[model samples]
Target chain A: MTQLPVRTDRKLGLVIDLDTCVGCHACVISCKGWNTENYGAPLSDQDAYGADPSGTFLNRVHSFEIRPDEGAAQLVHFPKSCLHCEDAPCVTVCPTGASYKRREDGIVLVNEDHCIGCGLCAWACPYGARELDRAAGVMKKCTLCIDRIYNENLLEQDRVPACVRTCPAGARHFGDLGDPDSAVSQLVAERGGIDLMPEQGTRPVNKYLPPRPRDRIGADSPALTAVAETASGFLAWLDRTLDRLPGGGLARMDAPAKEENS
Target chain B: MNPAPSVIIFTTLSGAGFGLLVWLGLGLPGVTGLTAFGFFAIAYLLAVGGLLASTFHLGRPERAIRAFTQWRTSWLSREGWTSVIALILMAGYGAGLVFLGTRWTALGLAGAAMSVAVVFTTSMIYAQLRTVPRWNMALTPVMFLTLSLTGGALLAGQMAAAKALLLLSGIVQIAYWKLGDRALAGSGTTLATATGLGAPRAVRAFEPPHTGTNYLLEEFVHVVGRRHALKLRAIALTLAVVLPLVLLMLGAGHLVAALAALCHLAGVAVSRWLFFAQAEHVVGFYYGKR
Candidate 1:
C-alpha cells in the first residue's frame, strides 16, 4: 500500500469580498444544509426554533457597525470561518494524527475515524474554526465542500462549494489560490485584499476584501449628520414614551437611549 | 488541569518512581552495597511500571508504536526513546552490580546519566507545548529536574540513614521550589503580554458566535476561580516544599522523611494540575471570552 504525501502544492482556498456582502446569511444556511447532509455527521441543534436555538455551523456572519471617528460610520459584515493556513498549528498539535493538511490541495481535513474527541485541535485553532460534534465524539470543520467540488458529474461552473453557489450577494469565491491567473487571485490583487489577524502568523490562505467606502456617508457631509441627528431625536422620543409603557417596551428602550447619547 | 485522576497519578507515580531510581543509583555505592543492589533493582521496576500505567491514558493504546515515528520534531518521541535507553542502561547497570561488584561504577554512572536524561525529556514534553503559557517556560524543566533530585536525595538519605545529606538536599529542594514560584509569576506576566492586553482589564463577551459551548471554551478557556487557585498554590507549596524541607533540616526520622517525600509529591501533583487549568490559550480572543 502506497502512503499519501502529507502536503501537495495545489493550494485550494477561499476568497471573500466584504465590499459586496449584504450579510443576507444565505451562505450560512446553505453550508448547514450541505454539510449536514454530506459530512460524517450532521451539525446537531438543541432547542432549535424554540427558546434557545443553537447548533454547529461552519460559517457565521458577524455584522459590526464601526464608528471609526466622530460622524464616520460603516456597517462591516464579516463572515468568519476556517482560514486553512499554510502553517496550520491545528495539524501539528493533534496527537492522533486525525487532523491533517493535504499537500495535494492545501485542504485541512479531519479523519473522523481516527479522532478521539480530545478537542486539542480545536484549542490550537486561533480562528475557532473547528468544532467538536458532541454526538459523534469527533471533530468537524468546514471541509470547503471537498465532496461536492470534486464530484465528476457536476458542471465546471457549478463545481464551487455550496456557500459560494448559494451566496445571493456574490460575496464568496472559491478557486485554486496557487494559480496566479485565477479569477479569485485577480480579484484579490485588484481589490487589495487583507487577511484577518495577520499578526498571528498562521499565513491564512483566505483573503478578505475590505468594506467599500460610501461617498455620501463621509464625515464632513453636513447632510448626513442632519439626517442622523433627526433620526436620533425621533428614536429618543419613542424610547422615553416606551419606557413609560408596560413590560413589552422595556427591552428596546436602551437602544434609543444609546443612540441619543452617542 | 481538572485534577483528572489519570494524569495526576501518571505524573506523581512516574516522578516518584524515577526519583527513587536516581537516589538508589547514586547513594547505593556509599551504603551497604548488597542491599543497595536490591533497592536499585526494585526502583527500576517501579519506574517502568509507572510509565506503563501512564499508557492507559491514551485513547488508542494499540497504535502507541506510531508515537516513535515523529521523533524528529516531537519531544514526546524523544522522551519515549530516552525512556527505553534508560531501561536498557539500568539493566546493564544492575547486571554489573550483581555480577561484577564495585567494578560496575562506570556503567552505574552511565545509568545515572540516563535516569537524569529521562526526567529532562519528560520535563521537555510539557515545556514544548507553546499553547499552554504556564508550561511553556524554562522553569518547567528546572522544576522537574529539581523535584527529581530532591525526591531522590530525600529517599537516599532515608535509606542510608544519613542526616547531613538529607538536610543539604532538603535546603536545595526548598530553594528550587521558591525559584519555581518566581518563574511561574514571570510566566503569568508573559501570558499577559502574549494576550496583548493589560492586567485588570475587564473583558466582556461582546458577541459570542455560538450560543452553545464549543471546543475552545471546553478545552482552553477553562474558568478556575482565582481564589481557589491561590489557595491551592499556597497549600501545595507548604506541604510539597516547605514542610518537607523543615522536617529534613530537623533530622527527622526515616519514616518522617519518607512521609515528607509523599506530601511533596502530592503538592507537586496539585501544582501541575493548576498549571493546565489556569493556562489561557490566545485563541480565546476570537470568542471574545478572554
Candidate 2:
C-alpha cells in the first residue's frame, strides 16, 4: 500500500550532530560505496572522468553560511537524506505502491520491482531525498542500510548503517528514536535538536543537533581591538593609506566625520 | 520544472481533447453516423495520443500498468483511473451515436461528467504538489477547468459560450500569473526554514552538494528569462483567447474555425511551456536557486 502506516513500533532513525560534523563527506563516500556494492543496483556515474560528472547518490553534503544578527558568520555542513517521516509524503504519493514506510521501524523504502519510475514520489518529497536511477530505472533513496542493520552474517558491531559506522567524527548516531530512553532520543533532548523544515509537517524521525554558540573570533575580537589601539608609526601610516582608498574603511571614515561634525 | 516537451504536449492536447469530449457528450452538434464518427475519431486521437506522450518521460514506461493500482492515495493514480474510465464511457457513447444513430442521454451525460472529472484529476496532480507552491492553489484547478471548457466551446463552435469563456480564461490567466508570482514568498518557506539555520534572510548557500548537475537540479531548478516569458504570455493570450474570439465573431465558417483551433492550440502550447518553466520547486532552496 502507498499509504503510510498508522504508527510504527519503533522509530529507528539517525541523529546528526551539526556541532561535531567536520564536513569531511566520509559518510557520503562510504554510503555510496556500500550501497552500490550490496544493495539492489550500483550507483552509476555519467561522465565519471570527464566534464559535467553527475551520478545517483543516496546521501549528499551541502555547506551553508549563516550569519547571526550580532555575530560572525558560521559555516554549517548539512547532510540530508530521507527523514522517514511519520507522514511520509513520498510514500503516499507513489502510484505503483513501490514507496512504503515500514510499520516496524519507520524507515521508508522503495520496492524496485513495483516502481514505474514516473518520479511522482520524488516530486512529493520536500527534501531532495529520492533520486531516479537512470541505469536501474527505479527510484533510489536512503534505505537506512536495511541489508546490514539486521544481518546475522556481519559482526554485531558492524550491523549499524555504513554511514554511521564510517563517520570518523562520530557525527551521525543511530538508534530507536521512538523509545524515549534511547541514547539518540536523550542526545536530542540534551542538545535541543530540531527538525529540518518542521513547518512542512513531515514529522521527520531524524533530528539535527544545532551547532553550539561560537566564540567571538572575527572583526569584533579583543585581540584585533588591542592591535588596532596600539597602531603607531609605519603601521598607523599603512592603516591610514589603506583607509583612504575608494570603498575602503567607509564605516571608519563615516565614524570620524560624524564625530567631527557633532 | 524542466518543462519536458512530452509533458507540455500531454497536458495541452489531453486537456483540449477531454474538453471537446465534454461538448460532444452534451450533443451540441447533434451529429450522427459518419459525422459523429469523424468527431469521435479526432477526440480519441488527441486524448489517447496525449496520454501516450505522458509516458515518454517515465523511466520505466513499460511498467506503466502498475500506475493504476494506487488510486486511493496518489493523485497521479486517480488521474490515470479517471482518464481511462472517461475514455471508456465516451467510447460507448460515441459508438451509440455513430452506429445506432442513438443519443443515450444518461450515458452521454455520465461520460461528460467523467470527462470533466478526468481534467480535474489531471490538474490536481500538479495542484496537490505542495513542494511547488505556484501550482498548489485553488486557482490552478480553476485555470485548468476554465481553459478546458473554453477550448471545448471553441472546438464545438458554440460562439456565445466560447466568447464568454475566452474572456474568462484571459482574466483567469492574468490573475494566475499575478498571484503565482508571489506564491513562493507567500508560502513562508525560506532557506532558514528549509535548513533550520540563521535568520530567514541571513542564511546563504555557500556550496552545492556536488559540482556537476544532479537529478534534483536538472529536474527542479529551471531558470526562464523574464523578458522571454512576458513575450510568450502576450503571444499565448493573443492567439489562444483573443484571436479565437475575433475569428469566431467575424464568422464561424469551417476554414476560420480550423484556423482558430490551430492558433488556440499553439497558444495553449506556449502557455503550457510557461506553466512548467515558471514553476519554482522548493528543493531549489538547498542550492540557493530559489
What would the TM-scores of all predictions be? 0.73, 0.91
Measured over all alpha carbons after superposition, the RMSD of each candidate to the real structure, in angstroms, is 9.6, 9.1
Error of 2 at B63 (Å): 0.6
* Highest-lDDT candidate: 2
Question: Residue by residue across B207-260, what tens digits does model 1's lDDT show?
Answer: 455556654566667775434877877776776667776677777676887777
Please tell me how candidate 1 rates in CAPRI terms: incorrect
Model 1 chain A: which ten-residue window has the lowest total lDDT?
Answer: A223-232
Estimate every model's Cα lDDT from 0 to 1: 0.66, 0.89
Model 1 CA deviation exceeding 4 Å by range: A1-8, A17-33, A36-79, A94-99, A112-120, A131-139, A212-262, B1-3, B25-62, B91-111, B158-205
Worst 10 residues of 2 chain A by lDDT: A221-230
What's the residue-level lDDT of B207 in candidate 1?
47
Model 1, A157-259: lDDT tens digits are: 7778899999988889998887889998998899887766555556778888876666664556664234353345778788567667777566766568978
The B-chain TM-score of model 1 reads 0.78
For candidate 2, the TM-score is: 0.91
